[model samples]
Target chain A: MTGLVSLFRRLEGPQTLGRGPAFWALFALVLAGALAYPLFSDGYTVGNTVYFFVWVFIALSLSLIWGYGGSLSFGQTAFFGIAGYGYGILTINFGAAYGFTWIALLLAIGMAALVAALLGYFMFFGRIAGVFLGIVTLAVTLMLERFMAQTAGPEWRIGAARLNGFNGMSAMPPLTIPWFGGPIPLFADVGLYYVVLAMLVLVYLGLRILMNSSFGNVIVAIRENPERAEMLGYDIRKYQLITFVIGAALAGLSGVLYTVWGQYITPSSMGMTAASLPLIWVAVGGRSDLTATVIGTLVVLSGFQALTIYGSQYALVFMGVLLVLTVLIAPNGLVLGVIKGITKLVTRRKQEAA
Target chain B: MALLQLRDVNKHFGGLHVTNSVNLVLEQGEIHCLIGPNGAGKSTLFRLILGEHHPGSGQIYFAGEDITTLKSFARIRRGLSVKFQVPGVFKGLSVRQNLEIALQSRLHGAALDKEIDRLLAFLNLEAEQAQLAGNLSHGQKQWLEIGMAIALKPRLLLLDEPTAGMSPEETHMTGEMVRRLNAAGMTVLAIEHDMAFVRQVAQRVTVLHLGQVFAQGSIDEIVADERVAAIYLGQAHA
Candidate 1:
């Protein structure tokens, strides 16, 4: 247990850790909870666990851009919706077959990245500030929503046999592992759960690498003080655009995975409500630490699931209260505050010993 | 030939002319100080040189090339660097990481680390190399800003009130560091209100009042000028 604590502590960084034994114990408990869910849970519970992992990917992407890059976006859902629809349209409507579906996913991510580049180019270059950036992104979400709504009409609608308008696209084929001879049955919820778990691990490792690279340092520096970064000979807009695109691509990947899990893609997923979830996850998880974001997602989603089962409408009220309290009392988020408190307690103990 | 030259630079906000046709020349390896009363457009002229703001009507030449329309980042890439009146180090980055970013702008691959280490030792920031920049003292922040400007060994460094909020000892230390940098063959243009510090280090001085050059000469010449003294007193004694 001590060795495991040390490993996670090393991963978290000295700036993020506490020196207290109590804090380590609590951290260990949380890690055990996260790792044990898939192992002991039934198929239905594991399916929800898979859903949470997919959301974790989305939350991580948001944490990178909004939390680290300091660019608040309300257009992330557009990337998710677009990519999901792109995959569905390519595979189902066009009958592009199996290997081509993977290619389609990549193309969807690239398209989403290109859109982010275009949006970031306009916003950062134009020097749009604060609420104006919010408004611009909100406007983009509304525009995409309107475009998807209109697709139900004559111009682009593939009829009731296709897109299905607000009803969403469904009946996506299950992902196949060609090495295993044929497609993994989508009905095998446990199998899908493991696949999602592997993807989440891979995505987490990839993000960790990107965040530690020289390019990631540039992104964080830009977040801290863009003017200073520019004075230091960095092309601030270029970095902003690149970070935005990378973040958008990550969202696209999550969206593709989400469609696979739910086997559906709806226009509502591209709306403001869905867009805001990832931001909330980043805020609750703590912006500075990526692992905190995953924990935050698990905590919030678990609370949400529990509330829905017990008291349907009241669950949303509980989340609202929790968000307000977290913002007012622990604006740095729960994980960071807990770490700091533990560190202080440890320092106080060492002083007493001396 | 002058490394940088400004001719007939004018800036106006409403009816107020902040800079009125100010002319100046900065030769290679010279430390030029621009000093005047508050609201005399000293910092405004610095902004013009950095391309943060364009002059109403004027021309700026850098390395004998016209750079009147270049953006701030472009000018920085072209060997012009400015440290703000308020130190602008990224608060989240460690001292070494901050230096590394600056060094990366000029050097790539294997040489980056060596350059960063050399800069860390030169700026005396090796002790707190792992500390976040926000943890640094005011004087250290000022030095870090200067270190960032000199990262690529820029041909010209423009400092706006480098020691605006430092103790006497810290100010003295900053003055010594500026001298060391100047002696190392980098041209410096410092905007300072500290007459004593400017007198101690400046090779030349330019004085601006109500948006125009009130006087221009050595520090001794400007300080001793009768008209310059009256401008400092807010009296029309020209």
Candidate 2:
């Protein structure tokens, strides 16, 4: 894993640029591993892995928004929930047929983007940044949780869908896409896992390409220092708003996928623990590098689930200790922290040889 | 019409009047230096010009257009760009990437490479082109920032304290660069504390005190004014 991570880092640097025979080799190996997952794991295992991939998508969005875009959001789950509910309402009557599922997926992403744009317009244009942004976003998330939880009556139903209070909208049909066959359901456990994994990889690659573009350069510049970027004639607010929408779209996509996987959407998904999950994931991974963020999310999240499965009384304690250690020793996140140490060791060894 | 003008601009932060009916102008192709002590509102006036703060009451005209209500980026699009007190280069990026971003603002395609090279050469930062901007020394960072401001293809360049923490040699070089830019037909409006730098580059100087223009004249004329000595030079003699 460490060797592959180092290879990934090399690929990120401009010189490698994600090409070269070694990169292709690593890519093939990872592809083989992902494809052969069903051989080694059961349907339940694949399902949970898909579940984990859903969070990974959200984690990547957070990394982009906070890490590169410089907008720390504690409420990204708000957008995720927005999409979940939006998808549920849009596709509820059709039961994943008539291709409404695809339309609903797009609409869910669009709704999240539009909402994010509005939120960003208000927050950034008002010059509400830094910790203030986090506070505002968290407030939005908590507000959604409370708002959705209160819809206990039949009046809360949109079309055939119901905002079923804490029980959530259960038995929502699985999302199906236009395959070689007409509108095939992605409900099969292994198939759903692959779909989620493919989306994750695609989103990852898309964001990577974007960060290398001039647009990405400009936004990151705005992130580093808004005033400086402003003086240079870049509209800081515009960049922030645009990136906010993109991140929201990604989150919305993740939420849609999660709803499909879980077969239900809930108000508690945006509650305290769930809302803060990505924060721990990205922070533990390190926000500086995208690869680190993904790895960190997988490692910590899997460990967390393992602890829960064993019914360890110290599960929460263990999570806290891991986070605290990352904050102290790694600070950059465990992946990058470990990478940095490795690079230093290599350089020292080279020096000794010299 | 002046290249840049502020007429009857009034800005007050509650009781503290940061700008009081202040009127200033930078003529085309001239190096105009605004100089004052710490509380003289020099920076505030610069902000007002850069659209960082809108004047409470007044008009700002740039290149014969009313730009009083314009945003900072809009004002910049109108050919006004600024370099702040701190160096404004994108530190995480390479020096070339920093210049490339600025170059991209006005130029694109194959032209960008040539422009980036020209800017790097102009600022004598060609050697540091591949280095991270944050790793550059103070003088080089300032030069890189200046390079960025000019890369905007600004008709009027606003620089705040360009030589604040420079070595004397670097200060001289910066003064020379300012003169070179002015000669190249860029209207320069600079707020500076280095009197020697102002003497080297300024065609005309404006002195402000207590949020208002105290005097405006040729550098020598301002130096000859007794009030300027008592107020700006901190002399007891009047």
Candidate 3:
């Protein structure tokens, strides 16, 4: 019981925003609204909203990697693409009977995490940091994209699945629960939406708990100053590697979900453009704060979708301009800055009343 | 056993020898100071001891164990801690959070909170615990870092220029804090420039010139040494 109380207390750590009774009340209200969203909306719009949520995992991963861990990585999309393709190959080859797709999902995520551990071990343990770390991650992302884009030959077959090259591998099975009355497919509809929603909530809260833990405090210390953290008896490389693997696994979760949603996996998901897009999503939303990243990701994704539909040529241009403006004006993040302003105002008013 | 022993340690950067065959030892329960002129490699020697930089040739032993190849964090885990020349505080974190990071490895729950409280009171930073370390005054930041090092409860504490940016009053207070820490069975090796602060705290002193140990004696004997006065004290005042 005391453990539970301490966990609740940790939810209000200084590294994140929105806490106390009011914040929880507001969070509950928002969650309730989301739970009730499909009741009022059409099926198509609800499915599209699931797409927006799918990308939030990637954004949150970047937030953890860059914002708190202080290591900029463009390799998240690589992990996403790896998991997506891994899911496709496994399901296409073995077939999704008896809910093997669930096991496959775990395996796919595991594959991405393994690759991340290998890559992160070299990068962090080798002591590559700052912009050089960025450069290395970008190189790895692009290298994977290029390698996957060329597997167009018949030799690219893995059991029953083909690497279809730039067209991507398609027609994979959706995630299924082994229900008593046969398997239930989560086809990006309201069912999948709820599952993804539950995941997001759990992940967000889990991150809050983790960020407030002793491990979390040490990482922030490393982010502030690696040498000082080392002198304080921390193996900074180990912490950084663990953080990177966690971020990669989350990205893998997104990849698996996205692939399951469309029943397709593509190399373009790990392309240079796709890799940089998450950076913008994370940076413009305030890279340091998870809440800001979530809000910013949803808002910007909606805006980008609208631009892509109406003014296709201007979509990338709009994103680039928005990124520039974010760096110039509210570098900490526009959403986070607004939240801080309101918090300060409320605190001052309460103080004055006292 | 001596708390720390460095034998024939040499470090070079290209052709320039930074630490030249430096041999030193610190007995347990002593407050020792390292004084040197510019480019005398005093800081470099500290780095070698901390294992931030390995010696080109030689051995470092701590508590009768050879730790020459041990990484900085490993050495630190064996009861070694340091307050760097710069105030290496987690500037973005609160002052209390800074100490929490230090004590979190071996402490938890109420014990963690209790230790944090003790450190805050020790540093006289109870009032500023909630303030961001970056926002603290220069002296406060230094004190907070000292508190962080002390939070580790190290057997050997290395303090590099602990009073670099402090006023005379603050420097005197720092000397008192160091003496207090030493009195509590903590051995300290401090690299300091202030003669007054050294006189106030140091029981023994070592003078380095051009990366070589020039003199080692009582503070008064070192102060009275014409050669140390000619090389270090004279150059410091210049």
lDDT of 2 by residue, A53-138 (tens): 88887898898889777789976899999999888888886677666787888998899999999998999889899999999999
By DockQ, the candidates rank as 3, 1, 2
lDDT of each: 0.79, 0.84, 0.93
True contacts kept of 3: 0.89
Question: What tens-digit string does per-residue lDDT give for candidate 1 at A1-354?
Answer: 975543343433322333357756775786577567767778887886777777787787788887778888787788888778777776675543455656777887888888888888999899885678778987897788767765664455453227767777888665544444754454437777777777777676566656666677778888888888887777888888887888788888888888877878888888766777667767776876676777787778777878889886787677777778889988977866775687689789999999
Error of 1 at A352 (Å): 8.9
Tens digits of per-residue lDDT for model 1, B1-238: 6989999988998898898988888998899998888998988998998888898999999999899998888988888988899899987778988887778656765688788888888888989899999999988989888888888688999999998888987788888888998998889999999877897789999888887888889988987898898888888744
For A228-301, candidate 3 gives per-residue lDDT tens digits of: 99999999999999999999999999999999998998898999889988899888898899999999999998
Q: What TM-score does chain A of each model score against the native chain A?
A: 0.84, 0.90, 0.98
What DockQ would candidate 2 receive versus the native complex?
Answer: 0.70
Q: Which regions of candidate 1 fall more than 4 Å away from where they truly are?
A: A1-42, A154-161, A185-188, A340-354, B107-127
Better of 2 and 3 by DockQ: 3
Model 2 lDDT per residue over B103-157, tens place: 7767765698899999899999989999999999999999999999998889999
List the candidate numbers ranked by lDDT, top first: 3, 2, 1
Give the clashing pairs for model 2.
none
**C-alpha TM-scores of all predictions:** 0.89, 0.92, 0.98
